[model samples]
Structures are given as structure tokens and as C-alpha cells.
Target: MHPFKMLSEYGPLLLEGAWLTIQLSGLALLIGALLAMPMSVARCSPRAWLSVPVRIYISFFRGTPMLAQLFLVYFGAGQFRHELQAVDLWWLFRDPFYCALLTFVLNTTAYQAELLRGGILGVPRGEVEAARAYGMSAWLRYRLIVMPHAYRIAFPALGNEVILLLKGSAIASVVTLFDLMGQTRAIFAKSFDFSIYLWAALLYLLITMVIVRIWRYLEKRINPHLQRRVIQAPKAVKTAVTATE
Candidate 1:
């Protein structure tokens, strides 16, 4: 069967599923980015007490499989029905959507936090020193010098993590989110044809290609200096280098 015909039959349903996937991913990423910044900052602090828990958090999340973590938080945590009910926070845990969102947020935040921390630490010391010498306050130093460079370094790494999260959304199906992968799985079960899986794979590949293009565009915009085809050094600088040699 041709791919177009297959899509024509189930295109609407798949589109709806893909839309949900996009929605879920967007919200999860927004929430994850917000949560990750402070956690990254905490991890970089000199105080062992502050950094220790962050270390454990990133270690725990990154160490475990996301699906296992989801299962533990959803089914495992739900078992504490009485305690959770007493606290009135059970509503959040009870809803599969919330649980899935929470799981994605926490998992991705831990990952992004580590990346951000690495990016921050990777900032050039000389640039930071120059900023400080220019009467830039600590906050200003971070805001102007550190943040830009850190983000420049973290941008590609963070983009990869986002793509990983996009793919990971498929795991939400097991929890009943009925996102793209989940809906496709249901369709596949009903039809008993592998074509659904193939279609789903194509859809995922298309989405990933979009993300790749976006990352490439961002990489160019964020570092205009880096986009040069060739850089010509000035005669004075070249002469100084030759004299030093």
C-alpha cells in the first residue's frame, strides 16, 4: 500500500495525536527549563550541602530508565492512597496526564540541569574576569558574561536533550496519556497490521527532522561570529605573531 493512502485513512487521528505530543512536549520543556536553572545553579555552588542533594537528584534520574521512573512514580506512588489522599495531593498523582507531565518534567530537568551546570562551568575564566574588572557586579557578571556563553555551549546539548524528551513521550502511552505513540499502538492492535507502526515511525522521523532544523537555525543565530566562512587576521596581529616566533 502507498504511504499517502495509509495517511489518508488515519491522517486525522494521527495528526491529533501528533498535536497532543507537541502540546505535551512544549509544556514539559517549559516547565523543565524553569526548574532546571536553579537546580543547575545549586549544583555549581561551593557549599557541599546545597550541591549534594542536586548531585543525588541528577544521579538518580539520569541513572534510572525513564519508563521505570514513570512506573515507580505512577503505580508505585499511587499505592500510598491513604497517605496521599490525606494530604489532598492525590489528585495530581491520580490523573495520568499530570503524572506523565510530572515525570517528564522531573526527568528532563535533571538532565538539562547537568548540561547547564557543565555549560556554566565551561565559561571562560578570562571573560568572567574581564566582566568583573569592568565594574560588573556578580549578578551582572553571570547575566552578561556567564549566561550568554553558558547557553551558547549548552544550546546544542540542550537541543539533543529536547529531542530525547520528544522520543521519550512515547513512554507516556503505557501510562494512558493517549499521545501519538499510545494512539498508534491502540490502532495497531485493532488493525493487526504493521503499517501503523511504519506510519508512526515516519511521523516521528518527520518531527525529529523539524527539531534538527530548528537547532541548526538557533546555532547560527546565537553565534553570529561563528558563522563566518573565513576569518582574516589583521597584518599588525600577524606581524606580532611572526615577531614572537
Candidate 2:
């Protein structure tokens, strides 16, 4: 079959898959970011009681493969179906989409927490001292000084994390979620067409390109002071003498 005809037939399915991919990735990133904020603050706490548990959580997720995590949530939940059903939470665990979303949220939360912790630690000590010298309360200091700076420092890495999660969401296909990779596999199964995979690859690349461009734009907007300023040499003034006496 000609490529155009193939695309015309499969385009809608691919679009649907792409939308599902975006939904899964976007929600996971947003929720993970929200959860990460407080977790990160706790992770950086001086008290072991506050920090150790968070450290362990981050280690487990970051140390293990995301695919393994997804499998654990999806398949492992079945082992305790009765327990989950007893609590009326089985409906959430049994659905592959929710299971996948939960796994992504858990996994990304660990990474994002670490990123934020690093950002928080990266804040300049002098600036923090200055804030304290101004008699700012801890909450006021964090609000006016620490968090804004930490987020700015972490912004680029956070964007990269989002891209990684978007690509990694392909793993959701294993649980029968019908994301982009899953749809591509289904199309290939029906037509045995090699070109379908190429189309999927292009679609993935297109999505990635869009994300990168948007990230760059937002990064520039947030870090305007970091933007490069072009310095132009002053033009030499030309004094023309009509007639030299």
C-alpha cells in the first residue's frame, strides 16, 4: 500500500494514541511535581526522622526500572485483589490506565523530588543569609527567596524529566493502554507493514520536537536575565570636510 493511503487510513488511530500518550505523561508530570515539592523539602530536612523515609522512597523508585515499577503496580495488585476489594479501592488498582498513571506518578515523584532537593541545596548561602538578616520568617524566606530560586535552577532539568516521562510512557502499552506504541503495534499486527513503525517514529519525534521548543521558550521567559546580550561596537562618527583650506 502507498504510504499516503496508509497514513490516511491509520492517521486517526495514531492521533488518538498520541492524545492518550500526552494525557498520561502530562497528568503524571503535573501530579508528580505537586507531590515532589513537599517531599523535596522534607528530603532536605536536617532531621533524620523527616528525611530518611523520603530518601528511601526516592532511592527505591530511582534505583529500579520504571517498567518493573509499572509491572509491580499492574500485576502485583492482582495478588491482593481481595485486600484491595475489601477496601473498595480495587476499582482503581484493576484498571490498567490508572495503574500506569500511578506508576508514572510514583516513579517521576522520586526523580523530581531529587531534582528539587538539589535545586534547594543549590540556592546560594549568601542570599539565604541575607534573607535571614532582614528578619524574614522561615516561611517568608522560602516564599520570597528559596523556592523561586530553586525552581529557576531546576527548570531545565524538570523540562528534560517531562520529555523522558513522555517517551517512557510507551511502556504503558504493555498493560494494554493503547498509547502510541501500542497503537503502532496493533496496526503492524493487522497489516504487517514496516512503514507503520516509521510513521510512529516520526510522530514520536514530532511530539518531542514540540516539547523541546516549548521548554526552551519557557526557560527563556523565566530566566530573562540569563539571556545573552549582543554588544555592538559604537559606529564611528564620520566628519566630512567639504574643502581643506
Relative to the true structure, how large is the alpha-carbon lDDT of every model?
A: 0.89, 0.94
Worst lDDT run of 10 residues, candidate 1, spans 223-232
Task: Write model 2 residue lDDT over 159-206, tens digit each, in one string.
Answer: 889999999999999999999999999999999999999999999999
Q: How displaced is residue 205 in candidate 1, in Å?
A: 0.4
TM-score of each model, in listed order: 0.89, 0.94
Q: Check candidate 1 and list the clashing pairs.
A: none
Best of the candidates, lDDT: 2
Tens-digit lDDT track for model 1 on 1-245?
Answer: 56687678777888888888888887998899989988998999999999999999999999999999899889987689999999898998988888888899999999999999999999988998899889999888877788789889899999999899999989988998778998898888776768988888889999999999999999999977778686578989989988999
Instruction: Count the clashes in each prediction.
Output: 0, 0
